[model samples]
Target: MDGGLMLAESLPRTSSFATDRQRGGAAFVERWTNARAGVIGFLTGRGYSSCSIAERIDDRPETVRRMWTLWDLSAYGHDGRAPQVVVPLSQRDRAHLAGAAATAGLTIEAYCEQILVNSIRR
Candidate 1:
């Protein structure tokens, strides 16, 4: 055999890691776009940027932006600036929710949104 080549050996295949890196680069672009949209939307609504929200929530700017995408609210004006809270409902509220859901032939969440929309319309 000469220094030129070896016919017995085939070239090595591409590494999955390399392919994944390429894919990750593209995915990063997509994720960044989503984050940008979310941050811009939040900024428009609350007069703040990703960093402001992150500081408010005790998270990093990028992390907060990622959360926006994860929550499926990366689009503009997706969610309000209200802080989310869990309230233990009284039996009365439960009954009211059930009745409203049944009346609308919708799930409890849908009924709640409907109620919220109506309340906000005022």
Candidate 2:
């Protein structure tokens, strides 16, 4: 098991979605620190779905999904400067790419972007 999963398992589980912001306007959302984002990315690499992550962190599944996307974008240097591009691959190739990305603790998009960046830098 990843160390992050172990630590996440020990987090206090909450049934309510209420927070300080709900009670008062003191806070709105939990700050996404580098460590927190990395943990989410790690869990994602382990094939945990967004719902699974949301349950673990006691947040909405949608929030987890958004955060995961944001983390991927930031980590891969995708500054939204370039428009999104789609690369269609065969089923076999897609599966292979996904497997490789999972092994490297990254999403398929992030893994592909990383490869592109590295190739450009070479």
Candidate 3:
């Protein structure tokens, strides 16, 4: 999905994470860090080297390599069970939501996932 559309779909759910500053500490950072590492690992497992993954994600080679070392291979076992959802939005609305997501310190995809998770809990 496009970044703008992802952001637009997540804007309404940003509030859930935004208000929970305490939960955004070490654990939150670690979660995202591990998740990134997991992605690098996944790509490498499929034969994409750290350099290639870095280039694809616009990250530094050294960073990607480091993440690769940190990736827990066991994490991939849960990948198939993760939920998937799609939300469509107009260009203008997507732009607005992307801006909002940036302000909330989240990538559009993360913001949307958080929102969906929050909605499910309610």
Candidate 4:
């Protein structure tokens, strides 16, 4: 045990262990860390697949799946969320949508949905 402890202590620690204050940017980290669960819940409630959530959050699907498992979100469909509508777009339009989504901190699917909904209002 002592030898194992000594070997572990000898290894270098990563910045991941750094505190929010130590990172000199607590706002982003704190906000996301606190809200991630709620965000995932919202997406799950909306019946979004893990892959879709991963695409929106710019994370790997496996990571999202692991999170879902850890969070005990298995109550949802095992096959994942149902498929959403698909809108064909040109390369230029796709780029524009991507930029808009990034600026709005939303995924392309979400941004497009919001746009479609707003258009219905008009």
Best candidate, lDDT: 2
Over 39-88, each residue of candidate 1 has an lDDT whose tens digit, in order, gives 44544354455666555434477876566677676355445454222334
Better of 3 and 4 by TM-score: 4
| Clashing pairs for predicted structure model 3, backbone only | none
Who is ahead in TM-score, 2 or 3?
Answer: 2
- Local error of candidate 2 at residue 45 (angstroms): 0.9
Model 2: residue 50 alpha-carbon error in angstroms: 0.2
- Report the Cα lDDT for candidate 4: 0.61
In the range 1-122, model 4's lDDT, one tens digit per residue, is 34223222343332232222324565445323534555556566555677666666556778777887776655544435453444557899899999999999999978988998899999
Ranking by lDDT: 2, 4, 3, 1
lDDT of 2: 0.64
lDDT of 3 at 29: 28
Write the candidate numbers in order of decreasing TM-score. Answer: 4, 2, 1, 3
Give the lowest summed-lDDT range of ten residues in model 3. Answer: 11-20
User: Which has the better lDDT: candidate 1, or candidate 2?
Assistant: 2
TM-score against native, each model: 0.37, 0.37, 0.34, 0.38
- In the range 19-117, model 2's lDDT, one tens digit per residue, is 322323555544454545555565565556677667865667788777757557557644333534456578999999999999999999899999988
Cα deviation of 3 in candidate 4 (Å)? 63
Question: Candidate 3 at 94: error in angstroms?
Answer: 1.1
